[model samples]
Target: MATYKLDCNGGSGNSYKLALYLNCAGLDWQPIGVDFAGGQTRDPDWRAGTNTMGEVPVLEVNGQRMSQSGAILIWLAETTGKFAPAGTVERFEALRWILFDNHKFTNNYAMHRFQVSLTAEPVHPAILSFLRSRAEASCAIVDKHLMDRPFVLGERPTIVDFSMAGYMYYPAEETGFDIETDFPALHAWRQRLAGLPGWKPPYELMPVGSSPPVRVVTQTA
Candidate 1:
């Protein structure tokens, strides 16, 4: 079995994506806790030694340090031949969804979750509104797409599913959107993914930032 180490915290859906893929794919992996709330990512030595981008989910595998959840997911899929797109057409299509997910689907919603439920500092109502509106729009698109398909790329689950599922398992309070009622299709889709073997919740896999409502709240000033 190949061993993998990833910088991870429970609060990070980005990290969850990679962790989820590893577990579901039956890979031997370990979570290396990062003090995200303790300013570990901002530390210069940690940055230089691990990931200069100062991001979690820095997967260390085969003597390589990989960053960016999408890229890492793609690399994992290609290397493992598990959860990969079928052909070139599916490959490009999966890329499209992954790109859209990173840019719009998870982007604003993640920031919204942080500001409203995770951080201790006060957030402007206007910012919250903007983020929510953008998030809702992207979410609607995803929900509609999922309405017809079992997964992102038809019947089989792919890396695109893992990518899009980054923030899906978060609580309604944290994400501020009750997916069960708000997006029926997406909620059902989340359930389907959860039913897969070797699946576990974020906090179960990485407990670095498990507590809610700030979890100490030292960052994001």
Candidate 2:
């Protein structure tokens, strides 16, 4: 059996995507909590040892360190012999959508959510409008791609679906984008993905003044 170490912040969508995939794959791995609220990801130890960029969902598999949620998802899927198609063309297609999600959808949504919605300081009107517009355009592209397929790869779920789902869902909730209202196919895809075995939401966003959320610890034997 291969042992893996996953360093992550519990509430982050990217972290949840990896967590869900690991669970679904029935892999033996350890989940090391990084407290984003306390800037634990920026800690020297985590940055040097796990991710130089200090990003969450960094996976250490058989002593090889890996970062980036989409890359990790592809690695896990290929390693576990699940969630990826067999043919070369099919696999390439899956990879293309995965890249699109990371480069296109996630980028725009992050700018809107973090820079505009979640910040303490006021955002400039021009910048806010630009981010929102970019986010909407990205979602429209996703909506079009998902129109005929239940998953990004095809009829069945794949690493691309798992990798993109969390990022897609984040904007829907944080930005009040209403994906279900605007894109029925994509909305149904979300519902289908959520119904999969071992599916779980990342973590509930805590209300103001609430106690800190409980962290889950995983041990690899």
Candidate 3:
């Protein structure tokens, strides 16, 4: 049996964060696809049993459940001693970037992608504009931060890279942002991280076609 079991939705960048890290680290893990569009995660039973927050990337290790990609990444880094911060300052920097990623980076980016590509209904133009602005802001900050660095922590890959890279690997159409064109520095950083040994794309690390199609309900008068 694998040492870890990850329950996640293929389209979820949060899930991809953990899944990608596990794959690149060459950990013994299994993927359990979640049905996000089918309301599987929203089910009371699931919420109470798996994750009280009703979120994806719920990792089960040694029969213990863990949630939140940031927390899990920290734990994994500490436990495995790979992709870990070198010392005190690096550790603090890593924590800062991870928090920034969760707050402003992946948070806005994933929300914008959901509105633009994942949702069946058309989102309001104003909402789309708001999301886009926030996402762009995060991108600009990270791009500038990585302008002269090889990785999030100056030299080597770390958990912060995994956190920030969660949504970057998805198709341009889905994300509606051409990082390679608009943000060259960020794009280069992504490529550098992708070159890590044992690295795999999101879909390859976890099943990507698990979410059920959105169904439309008709009302009879």
Which residues of candidate 3, in runs, are more than 4 Å off? 212-221
Candidate 2: worst-modelled 10 consecutive residues by lDDT: 205-214
**Displacement of the residue 81 alpha carbon in candidate 2, Å:** 0.5
Candidate 2 residue pairs that clash:
none
lDDT of 2 by residue, 1-221 (tens): 44977777545667767777776666776577677767767789968877899777788877798998988887777778878666899888878887887787877776666654455565677887788788888888887888887888778888878887765555444554677887677788888888887776665321111112332212100
lDDT per residue for candidate 3 within 83-188, as digits (tens), equals 8888899999999999999999999998888777767876787898899999999999999999999998888899999999899998776777889999999999
**Global lDDT of each candidate:** 0.86, 0.70, 0.86
Which scores greater on lDDT, model 1 or model 3?
A: 3
Model 1 segments more than 4 A misplaced? 209-221
lDDT of 1 by residue, 84-133 (tens): 99989999999999999999998877877777777666577788778788
**How many residue pairs clash in all the candidates, one count each?**
0, 0, 0
Superpose all Cα atoms of candidate 3 onto the true structure and report the RMSD in Å to 1 decimal: 4.8
TM-score of 2: 0.84
Sort all candidates by lDDT, best to worst.
Answer: 3, 1, 2
Rank list by TM-score: 3, 1, 2
lDDT of 2 at 16: 66
